[model samples]
Target: MKMICMAVMLFITLLSAGAQKNIPASDIKTAMMKATRFMVEKVSNRGGYLWNYSPDFSRCWGELEAKPSMIWIEAGTPAMGNVFLNAYQLTGESYYLKAAQAAADALIWGQHPSGGWPYMLDFSGEISLKQWYSKVQKGYIHCAQEHAHYYGNCTYDDAATYDSGMFLLRMYLLTLDPKYKYPVERCLDFVLESQYPIGGWPQRYPLRYEYVKGDKEDYTSFITINDGVHTNNINFLLACYTLLGETRALEPLQRAMTCVLALQGGKPQAGWAMQHKLDLNYSPGHARDFEPAGYAATATAEMCRNLMRFYRWTGDTKYLARIPDAFEFLESIRYSDAQMKQLGKSVKPGQILCPTFVEVGTNRPLYLHNDPDHYWVDYDYHGLITHYSSTRAIDLQSLKDEYQHLLSLSKEEATKDSPFIGQTDISGTLLSHLMRGKVQQADTQKVDSLLTILKKKDYLPGRLPSVSKENPGFSDAPLPSEVISIKEYMNGMSTFIQYLTK
Candidate 1:
C-alpha cells in the first residue's frame, strides 16, 4: 500500500516537471517579435500608424469613420512607438530607436491645429478630396476647380482633438523633446477651455460655428448627450497629470479625478458611471449606469497606475486607496475559468471572445451576436489580459493553465479548417497566451510561419483584411479589426513584455 502511494506521487511529480519543461521562453519571445513586427510594418505610417490595415485601405478608412474616435493616433502611434521602445530596451538597438522616433514624429505631426487630436486622421487624402468635391461649384468653385493648387497640398485634420492632445502628452513624457512640450501645454489649454460648465469635456469643440457647404454639420454636440462625462476623459486627464506632474495642470487633474469618483454609481455597487456633469459635489443622475463601456477597465487600471506614481512622487495614500476597488472592478469583468469554459463551448475551437463581457455586471452568458458578426464582438480583453499580466493579480499557474486550454482549443479549431477561425482569433489568443507566459514552441513556430506568409503575400503592409460577405456566417457589413486600434494593444503588449522581462 505504501509503495502504491509512493508510485502515484512520483508519477504526479514527473508530469509536473514535464509540463514545466514544455514551456519554452524562446517561443514566447519569437511569437512576440512576430506579432510586434507585423504591427509595426503594417499599422505604422509616417510617425503614427493607421487605425487598422485590413481588407484594404478603404475598409480601414471606413472603420475609422464608423465611430466617434479620439484615441487612434494617440493610442496607435504610441503603441507602435512603445513596441520599438521595448525592442530598444531589450536589445539596445539603434534601429528600434529610429522606429520609435518615426512613430513619435507621426504623433507630433498628427496633433490638431486646436492643440487636440481627432480620433482619426485622413492620412490617405481621401476625406479631404471628398470634402473638396462637395465644395466644388459652391463658394470656392474656382479654388476647387484648380487641381494643380490642391493636388498634393490637400491637408487633413486630426480625427479627435482630445485624444490627440492626450497622446502627445504621453509621447512628451517618453521623448521629452521641447517641441513636444509646447503641444502638450497647448492641448492642456484646449482641454481646459473645452471643459463644459457641468464638468466633462465636450465630444468635439468650438462647436464648428458654421458648416462648409456640402459638409455634414458636426453632430458631435448631439452625440455627447448620450456619452455622459466618461471614464475615458478621466483617463486622459490622469495621463496628463502623470506626464506633467506638479505643473499648472495638476489642479485640473485633481478636479477631474474627484469628479470621476463622485460619479461612481452606487446601485451597481461602487464602480464609476458616466456623469452628466463635471460637478464633483453633485449627485449622479438615474440616467447613468455602471457599464464597462467608456474604456472603464483600461481607464481604471491606468488611473490606479498613475495614482500610485502620483503617491510615489507626492507621498500620498489617497490616490493609492482608489486602486483596490478599481482593480476589483476589473477582475470582476475578466473571464473566469467557468466563463472561459462556456466561451470555449460556444466558439467553434480557434475563436475566443475578445472582450470577455459586454458590461461589468454578472449573470451574463457567453454568446455571439449575428449583427456585428465578426468572430468576436469585443476587443477589450487585450487590455484586461495586459493588466492581469502586468500586475500578477491572478495566480500565474492558473493563467498558464488557462492559456494552455486556449491553445488546445485554438488548435482544435484550426484542425476543423473553418474560415471563421482565421488570423483575428488565432493571432489575438496566441499573443495573449504568450503574454501570460504559457510558451509553446510548436504554436509559436506556426504563428511565425503564418506571419511570414502574410508578409510575403504583401498582406502585412496594408490594413487588416475584412471578412468576406461570401462566407456563410460572415456579416455583410464591415467588421472593424481591433488590430487597427494598435495604440492600446501596443502599449499593453509592450508593458506586459517589460513586466515579464523584469
Candidate 2:
C-alpha cells in the first residue's frame, strides 16, 4: 500500500513536470514582462505603489485614500519592489533593476530622519501627513486608537519599517551602491536603539504614549509581538549579520530572541499575547477595543513558529522546550462544534479551529460584537462582527509536525540548512530562496489563468466593492469592474519567476 502511494506521487510529479514543459518559456516571460511594465509605468505613483487601484487608474488606495504623492510601505511599495528585484535575478534585465532602483529611491525619500519609515510616505511632507492623520482620526469610527493622534514616529506594526530596510539591503547588495547602504545602516541602528532594555520592541518607536482610547493610555509603547514584530526584526538583523557581517546587530538580535522566551505566559497558560507590558506581562485591548488582553491564538501560533525558527537558526534545544506546552494549551482551548455554530463558523476538514481572543486567568474564548456605535467584546458569540473574524484557523498540527521534524534532524544536518551556512554575501540563489521562503508550491493552472487575464487587462484583477467619496476606505467585496492589485500582480509575477527559475 505504501509502494502504491509512492508510485502515485511520483507519477503526479512527472505529470506536473510534463505540463510545465508544454508551456513555452518565452510566452510566460513575455506575459510577465508586459504585466511588470504596466505596473511600473502606468499604475505607480512616483515609482512607488499602493495596495490597489481602479482599472481605469481613476482611483487608488493603500489602507486609505492616498494622495498622488503618497505610497504605502506595508505590503505596497516594498512588496512591489521585491518582485522587481526577483525579476531582475531571473532575467538579468537592466530594466527590472532600474525599476527596483526607482522603488528604492522612493523609499529612501520617504525615510524618516529617525532611521525608519511610517505606514505611508507622503512626498508633500510631514505637516501635510499629520493633518491627514487628524482627518482620519476624526472621521473613522472604528480603530480609533490607531489614528487617535499622529506621533510622526516610525511604526513597527505591519512590518512597515522592517520590510523597507530589507529592500534597501537587497538593493545595496545588488548594486554595491552606498546610496542604499547608509539608509539600511541607519535603519538597523534605529531597530537596535528602539528595542526595550529587556529586548521587545514597541508597536511604534520613540515612545510617546499619547494615543488615548477612552481613559486608557496608548498600547503602542508596549513590548509588541503582534504582526510578527520580534520575528521580522530578528530575521532582518540575522540577514545583516549573515550577509553584511554587521557585528552590531548580533548582540541585539540575541536580546530580542531572549525577550521572546521571557514573554511566554506561565505553565497553565503557556501561550503568548499580541503585546506585553514593559514588565513582561500579557497586554490586551491593543489598537482596538475588541482586542482584550489575553492569549491571542494567532500570536501564540506565530510564537510557536518563531521558537522553531530560533531553534533552526541556533540549534538551541531550549527553544523547543516550551512548544509542546503551547500546543497543548492551544488544543485545550479549541471551540467545540456547538460553540462554532453559535459563532456562525463552520470548521472545514483538517482545519485547526480556535477563537481569536482567549481571556486571561479563566482561559475562556472571547467573542467580539460590533454595536451600532462601537465595537465591544464579551463571552457571547452571537452577532459577531463581520469586519473582523472572532475565530481563527491555526494549524497546530503543522506546528507540531515542524517541531518533530526539527528534533529528528542531527545538529550538523540542521546547521547546514541555516541561511548563515558558509555564506559571506548574498548570492542570487540565496536571495531568491529568502524571497520564496516556506511558500507552498505555485499552482501552474492558476498561473496560466492569471497570465491569460493579464493579457487582456495588462494587469491583475483585484476585488473592490466600491470606490466613492462616501466610502473612501478600501474593501474586499467583489465588484463588476476589475481593479488592479499590487499583491496579485506580485503573486502572479512571483509564480512566473518561480517557474522560470525551476
Candidate 3:
C-alpha cells in the first residue's frame, strides 16, 4: 500500500531469458540503500505515503482514487510499516526502524476501537475522533451503514483495517510495545466478532445490512472475497495462532479454513465465487453488479495457492488435496487457443486472457457491462473485451509447471519431495532458502536487480490519467507526464519490495 508498482518488462525478460540466475548480496545491499533513500526522500510523508507519486527534488505530484493531486497521503500505506521492519532486519538500519515507528504511530491514530481502520483517514479536523462515535449526537460521526458522509469507519473491503492491524502485529513483535500488542489483540477480537456465525467474513462488518421494506439484504456484510476479506483475516489469525501462540486463535482459524474448504464447489463443479451470500447453503454468491456471482478464475487461483500455504503451515494434506480440483476448475474454463484465434485477439506469449468469471453449473465464461457502477453480465454469449480489470489475463503456461509439480506430489517420488534438492531453484524461492542460511550472493542480486528495474519503471510515463474535474483538497492535474501512479505496485512490484526487504 505504500507504493504502486506494476509488472515490469525487465522482470519478465529476465525470467524468460534465464532460469537460475543468482544475485549477489552486496548488489542487493547497495540497491536497498538506494531504494530506501528514494523511499525516505520521495515517498515518506510524516511516516505515511501517497499511493503513488513522482518526485522532482522538493516538489511532487500524486495520484490516488484514480485522480491526480499535487500532494496527498491521507489514507492507506500502513503495510509499509512492516516492510520497513523487514528492511531494518535486513540492513540493521535504525533509519528503517524509525521510519517504521512513524508509520506505526500513524496507524495507531487511524485505528478504530474495533481494531479496524478506514481505507482513507483524513485528519484535517476533529473527524478522526468523530469517526469512532456511534451516537446520533451533533458532531458525532455516523456509521457508513447509516450515513455515507462518515469516512473513517472500520473497513476490510480493500484491506483497510486488517492490513493495518497486521502491521501492528509486526511492530509488536519488533518492539514488544503494549500499544502495538493491544491493537493486535483487539484486531483479533474484531476478526472473531466479525465472522458470520457460519464462519465466513463480510466485506465490512458489524454485519450492517440494508433494511429494505421488511426484508434485509446483507449489502457489504455478505461473506466477501472482493478484497480477500476472509482469506486475509484467516491469514492474520494463522499468524496469531502460530507466531503469538494464541490458542484462542485456533478455533477461528479452523472454522475459517473449514468454511473456505466447504466454500469450494463440489462434484461436477469446483472453484469459489469472489463473494458469497451470508447464507452458508449457497457458498458461492454475489456482492456487487460488476462482480457477477460465479466461479472467479482469479480468486480460485489465489485460493489454490492459499490452500498450499495452509498445507505448508500445518502439514495438512486436506489443504493440499484441495489444490487439484481448484486447478481442475481453472483448467476447465481456460480459453482455448482456438477460442482466442476465433475472437481475433492477439495473445501474449506464455499468457492467455482467462475468464474472470464462470457461470456456476453452466460453466460458461462471463462478460459484464463496462460500467463499474452497474452491469448486466452475460455468460451465455461472448463479447469483445481487452481491459485487464473486466477480464484479467494470466501467464498460466507458467502455472502449468506448478500444476504438474503439485500433481507429482500425489506420487511418493523422492525427487518430488525435495525437487530443488539437486536442482536449481529458478522459481524465485526465498523463505526456506533464507531460513536455512543458504541465501547466496545471487539471491540478493536478484532482488537488487528487480529494485533497480522498478526504480526506473517508477519514473516511466504512460497511460497517465487526466481527471476531467478538479477534486476537493487537490489542485488541477499536472501534465500526464508530470503525473505518476499511486497504485502502480498493484502489478507485482509489491512482491519485489517484500522479497528484497525480507
Candidate 4:
C-alpha cells in the first residue's frame, strides 16, 4: 500500500511538472494580446461597449436593445475600460493604454452637461436618444419602468456616475493627463452640488419630478440607496479625496456617512428601504410595483455590510451600534416553512432566508407577481415575478461574526487599511486596491483553460442577459441566441491579467 501511494504521488508530481512545461507564460501573454485586440478593434463601438453584441455587430444591448452608437455606463463601459487599464498595468502595453484612453474619450463625450453619465448614452445624438426613449425604452415592458421616460439628466442610480468618475480618476492618476483631470473635478462638483441638505443624494440630479407611479411622484428625485447609490457616491468621493488630494470631497463624505445612519428605520424595524424621501422617510412603492414600500432584505444586508465598511474606514463604534438591531430585525423576519415552500425555496433552519421586502411596520414578508398590465402584492409567495428575486437569503451569523471581528480590531488597526488613510502614490495605491486579492496566487489551470478558449475563437460567446421580450421593441432585427459579450471578455482578460501579475 505504501509503495502504491508513493507511485501515485510521483505520477501526480510529474503530471504537474509536464503541465507547467507545456504552457509557457509567453504563450499566455500572446493569447491575451490577440483576444484583447479582437475585442477592442472589432467588437467595440468607438472604443466603448455594451453588455453584449452580435458577432456581425448588427445588434447589441445594455439594459435593453441598443443603437450601435450607444454605450452603457452601468457596468459594461466603465468595467471594460478598467480591464483595459488593468491590461496596460500588467503588460506595459501602449495599445492597452490607447484602448483605455479611447474608452475615456467616449465617456467624456457621453458626459451630460450636468457632469455625470446617463445609464446609456447615444453617440448618434440627443434626437436619436429621445426617439429611443419614446419608442424602444417606453415600449419594452420589463422591470425597467424607470426608463419609460428620458429625464435628460445624470443619475447616481446603479453606480452610473460614480463608476464613470472612478474610471476617469484612474485615467488621471495613471497618466496625470489634464483632460482626465477636468472631468474628475466636474464629477466631484456634480456630486457635491447635488447632495441633499440632510447629506443624501437624489437618484438623478437637476431633478425632474414628472414621472408618476399611480398617485405618488417619481422616486428618481428621492434619496436613493438602491443599487448602492450612497455607497458608490461616498466611495468615489473618498477615493477622490484620498488619491487626488481633493479636500472638497471630505465634508460631503462625512455627511454621506451620517445620512446613511439617519436613513435606518426606527426601532423593531431597524432596517432600510431602497430609497428614502427628501424628508428621509421610507420611499413608497414608487420605483416599481414589485419594489413596494418596505424594508428590503437585500438592501438591509448590504447596509449592514456598508456599516461595517464605514466602521473600518473611520474606527467609529457608532457605525457598529445599529448593526445588532438590524441583524435582530432580519432574524425576526425569518420565513416559515410554508412561506418557503410557496416561494419554491427549501426550508433550512438556522439559515436566514426570507422574502425580499418586509412590511414597513408589521414586519410581514411581501411577495409580488406582475404581468404586462398589472402588479399584485400579497402575503402569498406563489407566482412571484420571474424578473426579480422575491426571496432573499440573509447572513445573520456572518454579519454578527464580522461585527465582532470589527469590534476586536483596535482603532488604529481598523483605520490603517482604509483607502482614505495613509495612502500615497496614486498609481500604486489604486492598482493595489483595484487588483487586491486579484491573482494573489497563480492559477495556471485557469490560465490554461482561458488560453484553450481563446485558441478556439478570438472572442468568447455568451448568452445575452436581461432580455425579456422576443421582439424587444427596439428593432426588427432578431436577437441572436448568443453574442460576443463584453462581460465574458472582461472576465477572461481579467483572469489573464491576474495570472500575469501573479
lDDT (0-100) at residue 88 of candidate 4? 86
TM-score of each: 0.47, 0.88, 0.68, 0.91
Q: Write the per-residue lDDT of candidate 4 for residues 83-164, one digit (tens) a residue.
A: 8888888889899999999999999988888898889988899998888777765567667676778889998888889888
Q: Best candidate per lDDT, number? A: 4
lDDT of 3 by residue, 388-416 (tens): 34555665666666656654563334233
lDDT, model 4, position 223:
80
- Where model 4 places Cα greater than 4 Å from the true spot, the runs are 1-13, 16-22, 280-285, 346-351, 418-431, 434-445
Q: lDDT of model 1 at residue 145?
A: 20
lDDT values, one for every candidate: 0.42, 0.79, 0.58, 0.80
Look at candidate 2 and tell me the lDDT of residue 351.
Answer: 61
**lDDT preference between candidates 2 and 3, better one:** 2
Residue range 14-94, candidate 2, lDDT tens digits = 998888756678888889889989988888778898887777666666776556567889878888888888888889888
